[model samples]
Target: MSYSVESVAYWYLSKEEMSPKKLQKILYYAYSWFLTLQNESSDELENKLFEENFEAWVHGPVINSVYDQYRHYGYKEIDKFEGDLPKFDSEALDVMEQVWEVYGGYSGNELENITHQESPWLNARKGYQPLDRCRNEIEDKDIFECYIQRVN
Candidate 1:
């Protein structure tokens, strides 16, 4: 089943308290790994998981809508999520769980630092300043390549 970025973000928030910055980066990683995990086994699955691409912000890749929703909290950990919780099939849940298990342990700033060094974020932020608001979308192909390469 497909899930919205907000839905994924809410799921993560439900499990842990984190700043919006961390939520955005975690969603990006989850989306990336969801694609890499499936590989080419199902194009439909990729489309379902990635309804939209993330923009390269100074902090990291972000779903602008999701960011806007929780921006009021500033750099504080989000205390509550008001959106509907997303329901997924067992397979999708497994991927989400694995994503949290691996990346969830890091602090938001750490995730941001890691993304800054990664190709997908760096490539999209090419020519952008540290505080620039970049609309450049981090390509899924690049995300897939970067994560898949690390796994191999």
Candidate 2:
């Protein structure tokens, strides 16, 4: 049951008030963890949750489509969600919950700061200036490796 990035973002928003910047960072973290968990369990890649491509943007990893959806909120909390939440299976829900538990406590800027210190975002932003706007997609493999390293 693959979810659209918006659906996943909406799920997160439904759980708490989050800024667009925080939402983007959390979405990237959730996606990265999903890939890592699925691979570790020997699940097929097709069973992975979301397919949204996270680009290494100036603020860290971002899904442009999700960003456009929530951009109106600016740096403010998204108080309301208009979309229906998707029916996520137990495994998906479990993973999402864990992702939230591990990364949800941080502020948007903190999440961005954490990503900046991680290899996946750093590698993607390689050769780019600190504030340069980049569209380089953070590869799923890199995401998995980075998170798995921390988990082990």
Candidate 3:
């Protein structure tokens, strides 16, 4: 089913209750990947790479990473692995609202910083750094996993 961006974000950021360290580590890897791309590629190239690599990573190792970690921590039936998500068109707006509440309405720069911190690969793309752009697609995948746990 189709899920709104907000529902997806809420699921990822607010729904699941990951340990601070685990969450930080995950974000770190994502950010590092984004940064690596940013430092090495042009804007258009970086965007393409981020999009391609993110899709691969999300469906491949990244999903496994979350699953392994959650399973190790005794969390079963994680949504990322299960491919379950909310069905809503306004998901992005909801996610933005939640982000505003949690992050206190970050400026574009602040959002960029956060995106870089969370997924450096996507951040590497100069004009494509907004968390709401293609970057959100990858993050939302992760958030969906988190949301599943949080809602349950």
Most TM-score-accurate candidate: 2
Q: Write the per-residue lDDT of candidate 1 for residues 1-108, one digit (tens) a residue.
A: 467776777788888688988888888888888888876633333544658679988888888888889899998889856567868777668888998999999988
Instruction: Give the alpha carbon lDDT tens digit for every residue of 5-85 in model 3.
Output: 223333444544443233333333333333333333322222211222232222112323333445554422233323355
Pairs clashing within candidate 1: none
Which model is ahead, 1 or 2, in terms of lDDT?
A: 2
Off by over 4 Å in 3: 1-96, 119-140, 143-152
- Model 2 — TM-score against the truth? 0.91
N/CA/C clash count, model 2: 0
lDDT, candidate 2, 25-70, per-residue tens? 8888888888887786323455567877889999999988888877
Candidates 2 and 3 compared by lDDT, better number? 2
lDDT of each: 0.81, 0.85, 0.35
